[model samples]
Target: MIPETLLIEYNATLKTFDKDEIIFSEGEFARNYYQVKHGIIKMNNFNDDAKEFIQGIFYKRQSFGEPPLFIDVKYPANATAIEKSTIYILPKEKFYKLLQNNKEVHFKITESLAKRLYYKAIIASEISSQEPSHRILRFFDYLKNDVFKQEGKFTLKINYTRQQISDILGLRVETVIRTIKQLEKQGEVKIENRKVYR
Candidate 1:
Protein backbone atom coordinates (compact mmCIF):
# COMPACT_ATOMS: atom_id res chain seq x y z
CA MET A 1 0.00 0.00 0.00
CA ILE A 2 1.13 3.54 -0.67
CA PRO A 3 1.39 5.52 2.52
CA GLU A 4 -0.77 8.61 3.01
CA THR A 5 2.37 10.75 2.99
CA LEU A 6 3.41 9.26 -0.32
CA LEU A 7 -0.06 9.68 -1.84
CA ILE A 8 0.10 13.34 -0.85
CA GLU A 9 3.45 13.56 -2.59
CA TYR A 10 1.76 12.40 -5.76
CA ASN A 11 -1.18 14.79 -5.33
CA ALA A 12 -3.67 11.96 -5.08
CA THR A 13 -7.24 13.17 -4.59
CA LEU A 14 -9.68 11.36 -2.33
CA LYS A 15 -13.01 10.74 -4.04
CA THR A 16 -16.24 9.33 -2.65
CA PHE A 17 -18.53 7.00 -4.60
CA ASP A 18 -22.05 5.78 -3.89
CA LYS A 19 -23.06 2.15 -3.61
CA ASP A 20 -23.34 0.27 -6.94
CA GLU A 21 -21.63 3.14 -8.77
CA ILE A 22 -19.48 2.14 -11.69
CA ILE A 23 -15.90 3.18 -11.24
CA PHE A 24 -14.97 2.15 -14.78
CA SER A 25 -16.45 -0.25 -17.31
CA GLU A 26 -14.67 -2.95 -19.24
CA GLY A 27 -12.91 -1.74 -22.41
CA GLU A 28 -12.62 1.83 -21.10
CA PHE A 29 -9.23 3.45 -21.30
CA ALA A 30 -7.49 3.29 -17.95
CA ARG A 31 -6.35 6.66 -16.66
CA ASN A 32 -6.16 6.62 -12.91
CA TYR A 33 -4.72 4.71 -9.98
CA TYR A 34 -7.40 3.98 -7.41
CA GLN A 35 -6.89 2.99 -3.77
CA VAL A 36 -9.82 2.34 -1.49
CA LYS A 37 -10.01 4.38 1.70
CA HIS A 38 -13.15 2.72 2.97
CA GLY A 39 -15.79 0.23 1.81
CA ILE A 40 -15.70 -2.58 -0.76
CA ILE A 41 -14.90 -2.48 -4.47
CA LYS A 42 -15.20 -5.41 -6.87
CA MET A 43 -13.92 -5.95 -10.39
CA ASN A 44 -16.33 -8.15 -12.33
CA ASN A 45 -17.70 -9.09 -15.71
CA PHE A 46 -20.87 -10.73 -16.95
CA ASN A 47 -20.65 -13.81 -19.10
CA ASP A 48 -22.69 -14.75 -22.15
CA ASP A 49 -25.51 -16.18 -20.03
CA ALA A 50 -25.73 -12.87 -18.19
CA LYS A 51 -24.26 -14.36 -15.07
CA GLU A 52 -21.90 -12.10 -13.17
CA PHE A 53 -18.42 -13.34 -12.43
CA ILE A 54 -16.21 -11.56 -9.99
CA GLN A 55 -12.61 -10.97 -10.93
CA GLY A 56 -11.45 -9.69 -7.62
CA ILE A 57 -12.68 -7.86 -4.55
CA PHE A 58 -10.74 -4.90 -3.21
CA TYR A 59 -11.16 -3.72 0.34
CA LYS A 60 -10.04 -0.73 2.37
CA ARG A 61 -6.36 0.21 1.91
CA GLN A 62 -6.23 -1.96 -1.20
CA SER A 63 -5.70 -0.84 -4.79
CA PHE A 64 -7.18 -2.14 -8.06
CA GLY A 65 -6.91 -1.93 -11.85
CA GLU A 66 -3.19 -1.16 -12.02
CA PRO A 67 -2.27 -3.28 -15.06
CA PRO A 68 -3.79 -0.89 -17.59
CA LEU A 69 -1.79 2.11 -16.35
CA PHE A 70 1.39 0.05 -16.63
CA ILE A 71 0.63 -1.54 -20.02
CA ASP A 72 -1.48 1.19 -21.62
CA VAL A 73 -4.55 -0.92 -22.40
CA LYS A 74 -8.28 -0.72 -21.88
CA TYR A 75 -9.77 -2.13 -18.70
CA PRO A 76 -10.59 -5.81 -18.97
CA ALA A 77 -13.37 -5.74 -16.34
CA ASN A 78 -15.76 -3.36 -14.68
CA ALA A 79 -15.05 -1.93 -11.26
CA THR A 80 -17.91 -0.95 -8.96
CA ALA A 81 -18.42 0.15 -5.41
CA ILE A 82 -20.28 -2.51 -3.43
CA GLU A 83 -21.14 0.14 -0.85
CA LYS A 84 -20.69 3.87 -0.34
CA SER A 85 -16.93 4.18 -0.50
CA THR A 86 -14.03 6.59 -0.41
CA ILE A 87 -11.21 6.11 -2.90
CA TYR A 88 -8.00 7.97 -3.55
CA ILE A 89 -7.48 8.61 -7.22
CA LEU A 90 -4.17 9.52 -8.79
CA PRO A 91 -3.76 10.42 -12.44
CA LYS A 92 -2.13 7.60 -14.34
CA GLU A 93 0.91 9.60 -15.34
CA LYS A 94 1.37 10.96 -11.84
CA PHE A 95 1.04 7.48 -10.45
CA TYR A 96 3.71 6.24 -12.83
CA LYS A 97 6.00 9.04 -11.82
CA LEU A 98 5.30 8.36 -8.18
CA LEU A 99 6.19 4.71 -8.60
CA GLN A 100 9.31 5.55 -10.53
CA ASN A 101 10.45 7.90 -7.80
CA ASN A 102 9.54 5.64 -4.89
CA LYS A 103 11.30 2.31 -5.09
CA GLU A 104 9.88 1.09 -1.79
CA VAL A 105 6.31 1.80 -2.81
CA HIS A 106 6.89 0.14 -6.14
CA PHE A 107 8.30 -2.92 -4.44
CA LYS A 108 5.34 -3.09 -2.10
CA ILE A 109 2.91 -2.87 -4.99
CA THR A 110 4.74 -5.63 -6.84
CA GLU A 111 4.73 -7.80 -3.75
CA SER A 112 1.02 -7.25 -3.25
CA LEU A 113 0.27 -8.19 -6.84
CA ALA A 114 2.45 -11.26 -6.54
CA LYS A 115 0.48 -12.47 -3.55
CA ARG A 116 -2.80 -11.97 -5.36
CA LEU A 117 -1.44 -13.83 -8.35
CA TYR A 118 -0.50 -16.73 -6.16
CA TYR A 119 -3.97 -16.89 -4.74
CA LYS A 120 -5.45 -16.82 -8.22
CA ALA A 121 -3.19 -19.64 -9.28
CA ILE A 122 -4.34 -21.73 -6.36
CA ILE A 123 -7.97 -21.01 -7.09
CA ALA A 124 -7.52 -21.80 -10.76
CA SER A 125 -6.09 -25.20 -9.90
CA GLU A 126 -8.87 -25.95 -7.45
CA ILE A 127 -11.60 -24.92 -9.85
CA SER A 128 -10.26 -27.11 -12.60
CA SER A 129 -11.49 -30.40 -11.09
CA GLN A 130 -12.09 -30.17 -7.37
CA GLU A 131 -15.44 -30.71 -5.70
CA PRO A 132 -17.48 -27.82 -4.40
CA SER A 133 -16.47 -28.33 -0.81
CA HIS A 134 -12.79 -28.56 -1.63
CA ARG A 135 -12.95 -25.51 -3.86
CA ILE A 136 -14.82 -23.48 -1.29
CA LEU A 137 -12.59 -24.42 1.60
CA ARG A 138 -9.43 -23.82 -0.39
CA PHE A 139 -10.68 -20.44 -1.53
CA PHE A 140 -11.77 -19.51 1.98
CA ASP A 141 -8.47 -20.59 3.46
CA TYR A 142 -6.43 -18.60 0.97
CA LEU A 143 -8.42 -15.42 1.55
CA LYS A 144 -8.17 -15.86 5.29
CA ASN A 145 -4.57 -16.98 5.66
CA ASP A 146 -2.74 -15.46 2.72
CA VAL A 147 -4.71 -12.50 1.40
CA PHE A 148 -5.80 -11.23 4.82
CA LYS A 149 -2.62 -12.42 6.56
CA GLN A 150 -4.56 -13.59 9.58
CA GLU A 151 -2.93 -15.82 12.14
CA GLY A 152 -3.71 -17.97 15.18
CA LYS A 153 -6.20 -20.83 15.44
CA PHE A 154 -9.20 -19.22 13.64
CA THR A 155 -10.02 -15.57 13.26
CA LEU A 156 -11.53 -15.08 9.83
CA LYS A 157 -14.97 -13.43 9.80
CA ILE A 158 -16.40 -14.03 6.37
CA ASN A 159 -17.36 -10.72 4.84
CA TYR A 160 -18.88 -11.67 1.51
CA THR A 161 -22.39 -13.13 1.36
CA ARG A 162 -23.11 -16.70 0.24
CA GLN A 163 -24.23 -15.48 -3.16
CA GLN A 164 -21.04 -13.56 -3.57
CA ILE A 165 -19.09 -16.65 -2.57
CA SER A 166 -20.96 -18.69 -5.15
CA ASP A 167 -20.21 -16.17 -7.87
CA ILE A 168 -16.52 -16.15 -7.01
CA LEU A 169 -16.36 -19.92 -7.01
CA GLY A 170 -18.37 -20.33 -10.20
CA LEU A 171 -21.06 -22.31 -8.35
CA ARG A 172 -24.77 -21.90 -7.92
CA VAL A 173 -25.92 -19.94 -4.86
CA GLU A 174 -27.97 -22.93 -3.70
CA THR A 175 -24.86 -25.07 -3.89
CA VAL A 176 -22.85 -22.58 -1.86
CA ILE A 177 -25.55 -22.45 0.79
CA ARG A 178 -25.71 -26.21 0.96
CA THR A 179 -21.94 -26.60 1.02
CA ILE A 180 -21.60 -24.04 3.80
CA LYS A 181 -24.20 -25.78 5.88
CA GLN A 182 -22.38 -29.07 5.41
CA LEU A 183 -19.11 -27.37 6.35
CA GLU A 184 -20.66 -26.05 9.53
CA LYS A 185 -22.02 -29.47 10.38
CA GLN A 186 -18.57 -30.92 9.82
CA GLY A 187 -16.91 -28.36 12.11
CA GLU A 188 -15.19 -26.68 9.20
CA VAL A 189 -16.88 -23.33 9.84
CA LYS A 190 -19.04 -21.48 12.31
CA ILE A 191 -22.05 -19.43 11.31
CA GLU A 192 -23.34 -16.89 13.78
CA ASN A 193 -26.00 -14.32 12.95
CA ARG A 194 -25.53 -15.35 9.30
CA LYS A 195 -21.87 -14.41 9.37
CA VAL A 196 -19.28 -17.09 8.79
CA TYR A 197 -16.27 -17.56 11.08
CA ARG A 198 -13.36 -19.95 11.07
Candidate 2:
Protein backbone atom coordinates (compact mmCIF):
# COMPACT_ATOMS: atom_id res chain seq x y z
CA MET A 1 0.00 0.00 0.00
CA ILE A 2 1.05 3.59 -0.63
CA PRO A 3 2.28 5.43 2.44
CA GLU A 4 -0.01 8.07 3.91
CA THR A 5 2.45 10.87 3.26
CA LEU A 6 2.90 9.78 -0.35
CA LEU A 7 -0.84 9.48 -0.84
CA ILE A 8 -1.31 12.97 0.52
CA GLU A 9 1.53 14.29 -1.64
CA TYR A 10 -0.34 12.91 -4.65
CA ASN A 11 -3.50 14.73 -3.61
CA ALA A 12 -5.30 11.71 -2.21
CA THR A 13 -8.22 12.48 0.05
CA LEU A 14 -9.20 10.69 3.24
CA LYS A 15 -12.92 10.07 3.49
CA THR A 16 -15.07 8.45 6.13
CA PHE A 17 -17.84 5.96 5.43
CA ASP A 18 -20.57 4.69 7.75
CA LYS A 19 -21.27 1.00 8.09
CA ASP A 20 -23.14 -0.48 5.10
CA GLU A 21 -22.36 2.57 2.96
CA ILE A 22 -21.68 1.75 -0.67
CA ILE A 23 -18.28 3.08 -1.74
CA PHE A 24 -18.78 2.13 -5.33
CA SER A 25 -21.25 0.02 -7.32
CA GLU A 26 -20.70 -2.84 -9.71
CA GLY A 27 -20.15 -1.77 -13.30
CA GLU A 28 -19.04 1.71 -12.29
CA PHE A 29 -15.97 2.98 -14.12
CA ALA A 30 -12.86 2.71 -12.01
CA ARG A 31 -11.70 6.19 -11.16
CA ASN A 32 -9.78 5.92 -7.91
CA TYR A 33 -7.50 3.68 -5.90
CA TYR A 34 -8.76 2.94 -2.39
CA GLN A 35 -6.70 1.88 0.60
CA VAL A 36 -8.27 1.28 4.00
CA LYS A 37 -7.10 3.62 6.73
CA HIS A 38 -9.36 2.14 9.41
CA GLY A 39 -12.02 -0.55 9.81
CA ILE A 40 -13.16 -3.07 7.17
CA ILE A 41 -14.31 -3.00 3.57
CA LYS A 42 -15.84 -5.82 1.55
CA MET A 43 -16.26 -6.20 -2.17
CA ASN A 44 -19.35 -8.20 -3.12
CA ASN A 45 -21.99 -9.02 -5.67
CA PHE A 46 -25.60 -10.17 -5.44
CA ASN A 47 -27.19 -12.74 -7.67
CA ASP A 48 -30.56 -12.25 -9.34
CA ASP A 49 -32.33 -13.80 -6.38
CA ALA A 50 -30.48 -11.42 -4.04
CA LYS A 51 -28.00 -13.87 -2.59
CA GLU A 52 -24.82 -12.03 -1.69
CA PHE A 53 -21.41 -13.41 -2.66
CA ILE A 54 -18.50 -11.67 -1.01
CA GLN A 55 -15.52 -11.34 -3.32
CA GLY A 56 -13.03 -10.10 -0.76
CA ILE A 57 -12.61 -8.39 2.60
CA PHE A 58 -9.89 -5.79 3.12
CA TYR A 59 -8.51 -4.32 6.33
CA LYS A 60 -6.26 -1.46 7.41
CA ARG A 61 -3.38 -0.67 5.02
CA GLN A 62 -4.81 -3.10 2.45
CA SER A 63 -5.85 -1.85 -0.96
CA PHE A 64 -8.87 -3.08 -2.96
CA GLY A 65 -10.36 -2.51 -6.42
CA GLU A 66 -7.03 -2.00 -8.14
CA PRO A 67 -7.19 -4.47 -11.02
CA PRO A 68 -9.82 -2.40 -12.78
CA LEU A 69 -7.63 0.65 -12.44
CA PHE A 70 -4.74 -1.19 -14.05
CA ILE A 71 -6.92 -2.32 -16.89
CA ASP A 72 -9.66 -0.28 -18.48
CA VAL A 73 -12.74 -1.97 -17.07
CA LYS A 74 -15.74 -1.28 -14.91
CA TYR A 75 -15.78 -2.59 -11.36
CA PRO A 76 -17.00 -6.19 -11.21
CA ALA A 77 -18.25 -5.98 -7.63
CA ASN A 78 -19.63 -3.42 -5.23
CA ALA A 79 -17.42 -2.18 -2.39
CA THR A 80 -19.14 -1.52 0.93
CA ALA A 81 -17.96 -0.41 4.32
CA ILE A 82 -18.43 -3.24 6.84
CA GLU A 83 -17.94 -0.80 9.73
CA LYS A 84 -17.52 2.94 10.11
CA SER A 85 -14.32 3.27 8.08
CA THR A 86 -11.83 5.83 6.82
CA ILE A 87 -10.22 5.31 3.42
CA TYR A 88 -7.56 7.08 1.38
CA ILE A 89 -8.66 7.70 -2.18
CA LEU A 90 -6.21 8.58 -4.95
CA PRO A 91 -7.48 9.44 -8.37
CA LYS A 92 -6.63 6.97 -11.10
CA GLU A 93 -4.41 9.39 -12.98
CA LYS A 94 -2.49 10.33 -9.85
CA PHE A 95 -2.30 6.66 -8.86
CA TYR A 96 -0.70 5.85 -12.18
CA LYS A 97 1.75 8.69 -11.76
CA LEU A 98 2.62 7.58 -8.25
CA LEU A 99 3.28 4.03 -9.41
CA GLN A 100 5.42 5.26 -12.26
CA ASN A 101 7.48 7.32 -9.85
CA ASN A 102 7.74 4.64 -7.18
CA LYS A 103 8.89 1.27 -8.49
CA GLU A 104 9.12 -0.53 -5.15
CA VAL A 105 5.60 0.37 -4.16
CA HIS A 106 4.38 -0.62 -7.62
CA PHE A 107 5.98 -4.05 -7.31
CA LYS A 108 4.39 -4.58 -3.92
CA ILE A 109 0.98 -3.71 -5.32
CA THR A 110 1.49 -6.14 -8.20
CA GLU A 111 2.44 -8.89 -5.77
CA SER A 112 -0.65 -8.22 -3.69
CA LEU A 113 -2.88 -8.41 -6.75
CA ALA A 114 -1.28 -11.66 -7.87
CA LYS A 115 -1.93 -13.23 -4.48
CA ARG A 116 -5.55 -12.20 -4.67
CA LEU A 117 -5.85 -13.78 -8.12
CA TYR A 118 -4.42 -17.01 -6.77
CA TYR A 119 -6.87 -16.96 -3.86
CA LYS A 120 -9.80 -16.44 -6.23
CA ALA A 121 -8.74 -19.44 -8.30
CA ILE A 122 -8.44 -21.65 -5.23
CA ILE A 123 -11.79 -20.49 -3.80
CA ALA A 124 -13.54 -21.07 -7.10
CA SER A 125 -12.30 -24.68 -7.16
CA GLU A 126 -13.27 -25.21 -3.52
CA ILE A 127 -16.77 -23.82 -4.07
CA SER A 128 -17.31 -26.02 -7.10
CA SER A 129 -16.06 -29.39 -5.83
CA GLN A 130 -15.15 -29.43 -2.13
CA GLU A 131 -17.33 -30.48 0.78
CA PRO A 132 -18.44 -27.83 3.24
CA SER A 133 -16.03 -28.93 5.96
CA HIS A 134 -13.07 -29.09 3.59
CA ARG A 135 -13.85 -25.66 2.21
CA ILE A 136 -14.15 -24.17 5.68
CA LEU A 137 -10.90 -25.71 6.94
CA ARG A 138 -9.03 -24.64 3.82
CA PHE A 139 -10.28 -21.11 4.35
CA PHE A 140 -9.04 -21.10 7.94
CA ASP A 141 -5.72 -22.50 6.80
CA TYR A 142 -5.48 -19.82 4.14
CA LEU A 143 -5.95 -17.07 6.70
CA LYS A 144 -3.36 -18.52 9.05
CA ASN A 145 -0.72 -19.48 6.53
CA ASP A 146 -1.09 -17.08 3.66
CA VAL A 147 -2.54 -13.94 5.20
CA PHE A 148 -1.14 -14.06 8.72
CA LYS A 149 2.08 -15.92 7.84
CA GLN A 150 1.70 -18.17 10.88
CA GLU A 151 3.51 -21.49 10.89
CA GLY A 152 3.23 -24.98 12.38
CA LYS A 153 0.48 -26.10 14.79
CA PHE A 154 0.14 -22.89 16.71
CA THR A 155 -3.43 -22.00 17.64
CA LEU A 156 -4.85 -19.09 15.66
CA LYS A 157 -8.16 -17.52 16.57
CA ILE A 158 -10.55 -17.09 13.67
CA ASN A 159 -11.81 -13.51 13.63
CA TYR A 160 -14.61 -13.90 11.10
CA THR A 161 -18.17 -14.49 12.23
CA ARG A 162 -20.08 -17.62 11.11
CA GLN A 163 -22.26 -15.54 8.80
CA GLN A 164 -19.18 -13.88 7.27
CA ILE A 165 -17.59 -17.29 6.72
CA SER A 166 -20.77 -18.50 5.04
CA ASP A 167 -20.82 -15.45 2.78
CA ILE A 168 -17.15 -15.85 1.84
CA LEU A 169 -17.34 -19.59 1.28
CA GLY A 170 -20.62 -19.73 -0.61
CA LEU A 171 -22.32 -21.81 2.11
CA ARG A 172 -25.47 -21.26 4.10
CA VAL A 173 -24.98 -19.87 7.61
CA GLU A 174 -26.64 -23.00 9.06
CA THR A 175 -24.19 -25.17 7.14
CA VAL A 176 -21.25 -23.16 8.47
CA ILE A 177 -22.57 -23.47 12.04
CA ARG A 178 -23.08 -27.24 11.67
CA THR A 179 -19.64 -27.69 10.13
CA ILE A 180 -17.90 -25.71 12.88
CA LYS A 181 -19.62 -27.82 15.52
CA GLN A 182 -18.60 -30.96 13.66
CA LEU A 183 -15.02 -29.71 13.38
CA GLU A 184 -14.96 -29.12 17.11
CA LYS A 185 -16.27 -32.61 17.86
CA GLN A 186 -13.69 -34.12 15.51
CA GLY A 187 -10.87 -32.29 17.34
CA GLU A 188 -10.05 -30.27 14.25
CA VAL A 189 -10.86 -26.97 15.93
CA LYS A 190 -11.32 -25.61 19.44
CA ILE A 191 -14.41 -23.70 20.49
CA GLU A 192 -13.69 -21.75 23.63
CA ASN A 193 -16.30 -19.41 25.04
CA ARG A 194 -18.08 -19.27 21.67
CA LYS A 195 -14.90 -18.29 19.84
CA VAL A 196 -13.35 -20.56 17.22
CA TYR A 197 -9.64 -21.38 17.21
CA ARG A 198 -7.66 -23.53 14.80
Candidate 3:
Protein backbone atom coordinates (compact mmCIF):
# COMPACT_ATOMS: atom_id res chain seq x y z
CA MET A 1 0.00 0.00 0.00
CA ILE A 2 1.06 3.62 -0.56
CA PRO A 3 2.36 5.46 2.48
CA GLU A 4 0.07 7.97 4.21
CA THR A 5 2.45 10.87 3.60
CA LEU A 6 2.65 10.06 -0.09
CA LEU A 7 -1.12 9.72 -0.31
CA ILE A 8 -1.52 13.13 1.28
CA GLU A 9 1.17 14.62 -0.97
CA TYR A 10 -0.91 13.46 -3.93
CA ASN A 11 -4.01 15.22 -2.54
CA ALA A 12 -5.71 12.16 -1.17
CA THR A 13 -8.49 12.85 1.31
CA LEU A 14 -9.36 10.85 4.41
CA LYS A 15 -13.05 10.19 4.80
CA THR A 16 -15.09 8.35 7.42
CA PHE A 17 -17.88 5.87 6.68
CA ASP A 18 -20.57 4.45 8.90
CA LYS A 19 -21.07 0.72 9.22
CA ASP A 20 -22.84 -0.81 6.15
CA GLU A 21 -22.37 2.40 4.18
CA ILE A 22 -22.00 1.85 0.49
CA ILE A 23 -18.67 3.29 -0.64
CA PHE A 24 -19.29 2.54 -4.30
CA SER A 25 -21.87 0.53 -6.22
CA GLU A 26 -21.41 -2.18 -8.75
CA GLY A 27 -21.02 -0.91 -12.33
CA GLU A 28 -19.95 2.55 -11.17
CA PHE A 29 -17.01 4.03 -13.02
CA ALA A 30 -13.85 3.73 -10.99
CA ARG A 31 -12.72 7.21 -10.04
CA ASN A 32 -10.54 6.77 -6.97
CA TYR A 33 -8.09 4.47 -5.25
CA TYR A 34 -9.18 3.53 -1.71
CA GLN A 35 -6.85 2.50 1.09
CA VAL A 36 -8.19 1.54 4.49
CA LYS A 37 -6.94 3.82 7.26
CA HIS A 38 -8.99 2.10 9.94
CA GLY A 39 -11.56 -0.70 10.17
CA ILE A 40 -12.69 -3.01 7.39
CA ILE A 41 -14.18 -2.87 3.88
CA LYS A 42 -15.77 -5.67 1.91
CA MET A 43 -16.36 -5.91 -1.82
CA ASN A 44 -19.42 -7.99 -2.58
CA ASN A 45 -22.22 -8.85 -4.97
CA PHE A 46 -25.73 -10.15 -4.54
CA ASN A 47 -27.24 -12.83 -6.71
CA ASP A 48 -30.77 -12.97 -8.11
CA ASP A 49 -31.97 -14.60 -4.91
CA ALA A 50 -30.34 -11.85 -2.87
CA LYS A 51 -27.59 -14.06 -1.56
CA GLU A 52 -24.46 -12.12 -0.83
CA PHE A 53 -21.10 -13.28 -2.09
CA ILE A 54 -18.05 -11.58 -0.69
CA GLN A 55 -15.43 -10.91 -3.32
CA GLY A 56 -12.88 -9.77 -0.79
CA ILE A 57 -12.39 -8.23 2.65
CA PHE A 58 -9.69 -5.63 3.14
CA TYR A 59 -8.12 -4.48 6.40
CA LYS A 60 -6.01 -1.54 7.53
CA ARG A 61 -3.19 -0.49 5.17
CA GLN A 62 -4.75 -2.66 2.46
CA SER A 63 -6.02 -1.15 -0.78
CA PHE A 64 -9.12 -2.23 -2.71
CA GLY A 65 -10.90 -1.37 -5.98
CA GLU A 66 -7.67 -0.63 -7.86
CA PRO A 67 -7.93 -3.06 -10.75
CA PRO A 68 -10.66 -1.01 -12.37
CA LEU A 69 -8.51 2.10 -12.06
CA PHE A 70 -5.67 0.33 -13.88
CA ILE A 71 -8.01 -0.80 -16.63
CA ASP A 72 -10.89 1.24 -18.03
CA VAL A 73 -13.85 -0.61 -16.54
CA LYS A 74 -16.72 -0.14 -14.15
CA TYR A 75 -16.50 -1.76 -10.72
CA PRO A 76 -17.64 -5.37 -10.77
CA ALA A 77 -18.73 -5.43 -7.12
CA ASN A 78 -20.06 -3.01 -4.54
CA ALA A 79 -17.67 -1.86 -1.83
CA THR A 80 -19.21 -1.37 1.60
CA ALA A 81 -17.82 -0.37 4.95
CA ILE A 82 -18.47 -3.42 7.10
CA GLU A 83 -17.71 -1.38 10.22
CA LYS A 84 -17.32 2.30 11.07
CA SER A 85 -14.20 3.04 9.05
CA THR A 86 -11.87 5.73 7.79
CA ILE A 87 -10.38 5.47 4.33
CA TYR A 88 -7.88 7.40 2.26
CA ILE A 89 -9.27 8.24 -1.15
CA LEU A 90 -6.98 9.27 -4.00
CA PRO A 91 -8.40 10.43 -7.29
CA LYS A 92 -7.69 8.15 -10.22
CA GLU A 93 -5.68 10.79 -12.12
CA LYS A 94 -3.54 11.59 -9.11
CA PHE A 95 -3.18 7.92 -8.34
CA TYR A 96 -1.83 7.31 -11.83
CA LYS A 97 0.57 10.21 -11.47
CA LEU A 98 1.79 8.94 -8.11
CA LEU A 99 2.43 5.50 -9.49
CA GLN A 100 4.26 6.90 -12.50
CA ASN A 101 6.47 8.98 -10.25
CA ASN A 102 7.08 6.11 -7.80
CA LYS A 103 8.26 2.89 -9.39
CA GLU A 104 8.60 1.01 -6.11
CA VAL A 105 5.05 1.83 -5.11
CA HIS A 106 3.81 0.77 -8.54
CA PHE A 107 5.57 -2.57 -8.27
CA LYS A 108 4.09 -3.14 -4.86
CA ILE A 109 0.61 -2.48 -6.19
CA THR A 110 1.14 -4.97 -9.01
CA GLU A 111 2.36 -7.59 -6.54
CA SER A 112 -0.67 -7.09 -4.31
CA LEU A 113 -3.07 -7.37 -7.24
CA ALA A 114 -1.36 -10.55 -8.40
CA LYS A 115 -1.77 -12.13 -5.00
CA ARG A 116 -5.46 -11.26 -4.99
CA LEU A 117 -5.87 -12.86 -8.40
CA TYR A 118 -4.23 -16.00 -7.07
CA TYR A 119 -6.60 -16.05 -4.10
CA LYS A 120 -9.65 -15.59 -6.28
CA ALA A 121 -8.61 -18.47 -8.51
CA ILE A 122 -8.05 -20.80 -5.57
CA ILE A 123 -11.31 -19.86 -3.84
CA ALA A 124 -13.30 -20.19 -7.03
CA SER A 125 -11.99 -23.72 -7.47
CA GLU A 126 -12.73 -24.62 -3.87
CA ILE A 127 -16.28 -23.39 -4.08
CA SER A 128 -16.94 -25.29 -7.26
CA SER A 129 -15.47 -28.66 -6.27
CA GLN A 130 -14.41 -28.93 -2.64
CA GLU A 131 -16.54 -30.10 0.26
CA PRO A 132 -17.63 -27.58 2.86
CA SER A 133 -15.04 -28.71 5.37
CA HIS A 134 -12.26 -28.68 2.81
CA ARG A 135 -13.21 -25.23 1.59
CA ILE A 136 -13.30 -23.89 5.11
CA LEU A 137 -9.94 -25.35 5.99
CA ARG A 138 -8.33 -24.04 2.82
CA PHE A 139 -9.79 -20.59 3.41
CA PHE A 140 -8.52 -20.52 7.00
CA ASP A 141 -5.11 -21.77 5.91
CA TYR A 142 -4.92 -19.00 3.32
CA LEU A 143 -5.73 -16.38 5.95
CA LYS A 144 -3.20 -17.72 8.43
CA ASN A 145 -0.38 -18.42 6.00
CA ASP A 146 -0.77 -15.89 3.21
CA VAL A 147 -2.66 -12.97 4.71
CA PHE A 148 -1.31 -12.98 8.23
CA LYS A 149 2.08 -14.40 7.20
CA GLN A 150 2.19 -16.78 10.14
CA GLU A 151 4.29 -19.93 9.91
CA GLY A 152 4.63 -23.27 11.71
CA LYS A 153 1.83 -24.49 14.01
CA PHE A 154 1.28 -21.31 15.88
CA THR A 155 -2.23 -20.68 17.21
CA LEU A 156 -3.88 -18.08 14.97
CA LYS A 157 -7.26 -16.76 16.02
CA ILE A 158 -9.79 -16.39 13.22
CA ASN A 159 -10.70 -12.78 12.65
CA TYR A 160 -13.89 -13.41 10.70
CA THR A 161 -17.29 -14.27 12.12
CA ARG A 162 -19.15 -17.42 11.12
CA GLN A 163 -21.56 -15.46 8.95
CA GLN A 164 -18.70 -13.69 7.22
CA ILE A 165 -16.97 -16.99 6.59
CA SER A 166 -20.20 -18.45 5.18
CA ASP A 167 -20.66 -15.52 2.80
CA ILE A 168 -17.08 -15.70 1.65
CA LEU A 169 -17.14 -19.44 1.10
CA GLY A 170 -20.59 -19.61 -0.55
CA LEU A 171 -22.01 -21.75 2.25
CA ARG A 172 -24.94 -21.35 4.59
CA VAL A 173 -24.23 -20.10 8.10
CA GLU A 174 -25.55 -23.36 9.57
CA THR A 175 -23.13 -25.29 7.35
CA VAL A 176 -20.24 -23.18 8.53
CA ILE A 177 -21.24 -23.64 12.17
CA ARG A 178 -21.63 -27.37 11.82
CA THR A 179 -18.38 -27.66 9.89
CA ILE A 180 -16.46 -25.72 12.50
CA LYS A 181 -17.77 -27.92 15.26
CA GLN A 182 -16.94 -31.01 13.19
CA LEU A 183 -13.48 -29.65 12.54
CA GLU A 184 -13.04 -29.17 16.26
CA LYS A 185 -14.13 -32.71 17.02
CA GLN A 186 -11.75 -33.99 14.35
CA GLY A 187 -8.88 -32.15 16.08
CA GLU A 188 -8.41 -29.84 13.12
CA VAL A 189 -9.18 -26.64 15.02
CA LYS A 190 -9.51 -25.48 18.58
CA ILE A 191 -12.55 -23.65 19.86
CA GLU A 192 -11.73 -21.85 23.08
CA ASN A 193 -14.34 -19.64 24.74
CA ARG A 194 -16.35 -19.34 21.52
CA LYS A 195 -13.33 -18.11 19.54
CA VAL A 196 -11.88 -20.31 16.84
CA TYR A 197 -8.13 -20.97 16.67
CA ARG A 198 -5.87 -22.97 14.38
Q: Judged by lDDT, which candidate is best?
A: 3
Each prediction's whole-model lDDT (CA): 0.90, 0.93, 0.94
Model 2 has an lDDT value of 0.93
| Candidate 2, position 44, lDDT | 96
Residue-level lDDT tens digits of model 3 in 38-83: 9999999999999999999999999999999988899999999999
TM-score of each: 0.97, 0.94, 0.96
Candidates, ranked, TM-score: 1, 3, 2
Clashing pairs in 2: none
Superposed on all Cα atoms, model 1 deviates from the true structure by an RMSD in Å of 1.0
The model with the greater TM-score, 2 or 3, is 3
Could you give candidate 2's per-residue lDDT for residues 124-151 as a string of tens digits? 9999999999999999998888777776
Residue 149 in model 2: lDDT: 73
lDDT for predicted candidate 3 compared with the true structure: 0.94
